[model samples]
Target chain A: MDSEYLGYAAGILTTVAFLPQAMQLIRTRQARDISLTWAATMTAGVFFWLCYGVAKQSVPMISANGITLLLLLVILFIKLRYQDSTDTGEK
Target chain B: MDSEYLGYAAGILTTVAFLPQAMQLIRTRQARDISLTWAATMTAGVFFWLCYGVAKQSVPMISANGITLLLLLVILFIKLRYQDSTDTGEK
Candidate 1:
């Protein structure tokens, strides 16, 4: 197999690996326990990863991390939005 | 920056990215809408990615994906356990 194929497989694996959490949060609308600090740090890291991918001209890395970043951001946003009123003390 | 440091940064970012969701679910004990199929596929993908990381001797990839796999697994397990029993129409 070619290196691109391997990269594609890696991209798919890493990107899709986050689907369950994203789907669950979206479906349930529950975001009380998510932490701002953790989310912020992760988001920053993802952004950097995206830049790294771009710097390396690696489409697989860019695409996969990009999609994963978007998915993760939504949950982070929801957590920020409803964390205070959820009464779950999750934040 | 050194390659090792770069890899370490990537690992930190990716590994901790899922913290919010994990913390939330564990705090709320709620897992009503997570899809078994999605979770299963993602878990499998993570496993493959882990193997890929290992084969490449990429500690950054391995460590990051490994931690992510654990976090995702916990959420998936909780979702499976209560997915059928919960009545939120999420599953």
Candidate 2:
């Protein structure tokens, strides 16, 4: 396969990986164990990656980051919503 | 800034975002709340990403995926290690 295909395969794998967590969170409404910092930082990071993809004109990067950004935002929102109730006092 | 710089910045942000979770996992020895499916799938996905980076000869992708893969592995290991003890019964 071509390198571009490889990139897309990799992107698909990474992007799909988030689905299980997102679905679980949506179903259970539990975000106590997840790190807020990780979610927030990842959201920012993915946003930058979307920008990078635009700059590079790479479809794989753009598509993957776009979807991943939405996933991260979902996780982040869950984290924030449940933040008060599920305090582990770690952060 | 150059597009390359944007790529690097994006890579850095995403890579660093994993640290907080990793650190917290190490400190608390708690993996009950983390999704095993997420960690395992992410590890596999990141491994593919490293391969993709190698194929593309992209320094940022290689470096970022390399570190992220290791971090995922750490999380996976923790999840597996504590899998029996802290069963949330959600799996």
Candidate 3:
């Protein structure tokens, strides 16, 4: 019932939400078809969330967004790298 | 400087972040490598965020997560369907 607990719960839940996509991307190493617009948008959202968390000094927000950002970054990188390679026909 | 503007800014940013990924997935119609676990986890997070938003009566949180939940649902559905089709080998 505590606010802290509530925030933590939210953090954990949201973090896990990203797991399915993250795991899939990591395993396959293919991100060519994913939407550049969508990923870019989400990254912006996470960045704002991180900033908001900092501004509000909300630990839950900070932790959750930080981790989400990292996960997203990985996905984004895979997507870009895959596209780059495919375009170059390196693999 | 208003809180409303700040919240909206965050929402837009995060939403845009997901743009790239969403676009890629939609264009290629490929969700084979995405992880079920990660998607489930992200769903949970969004669910909690929705709950928290409701409890707190935070319009910004509610709006952002509501849209996010919908987007994620689409991705999840595509992934499942793709797997099902691949399993059946009808395509």
- Enumerate the candidates' DockQ scores in order: 0.33, 0.59, 0.48
Query: For candidate 3, lDDT tens digit of each residue in A1-91?
Result: 6554555787887775566576667776765545656666677777777878887888877888898888888777777776543322121
- Of 2 and 3, the candidate ahead on TM-score is 2
lDDT for model 3: 0.67
lDDT of 1 by residue, A1-91 (tens): 4444554576686577557666766766764434566667777887777877777787876887899889779767766765565332222
Candidate with the greatest TM-score versus the true structure? 2
TM-score of the first chain in candidate 2 relative to the native first chain: 0.84
TM-score each candidate. 0.70, 0.87, 0.76
Order of all candidates by lDDT, from best down to worst?
2, 3, 1
lDDT of 3 by residue, B1-91 (tens): 5554655787777654544555555665666555666666676777787878887888877887888788777777777766443322112
Pull out the clashing pairs in model 1: none
Classify candidate 1 by CAPRI docking class. acceptable
Model 2, residue A66: C-alpha shift (Å): 1.0
Docking model 2 quality class = medium
Label model 3 with its docking quality class.
Answer: acceptable
Report the number of the highest-DockQ candidate: 2
Tens digits of per-residue lDDT for model 2 on B1-91? 7887777778898899889998878877766657788898888888888989999898878999999999988889987986566433344
Model 1 C-alpha lDDT per residue in residues B1-91, reported as the tens digit of each score: 5444554676687678667666766776765434466567767777777777777788866877898889889878876775555333222
Model 1: what is its DockQ?
A: 0.33
Shift in Å, residue B4, candidate 3: 6.1
State the iRMSD of every prediction, in order shown. 4.6, 3.2, 5.3
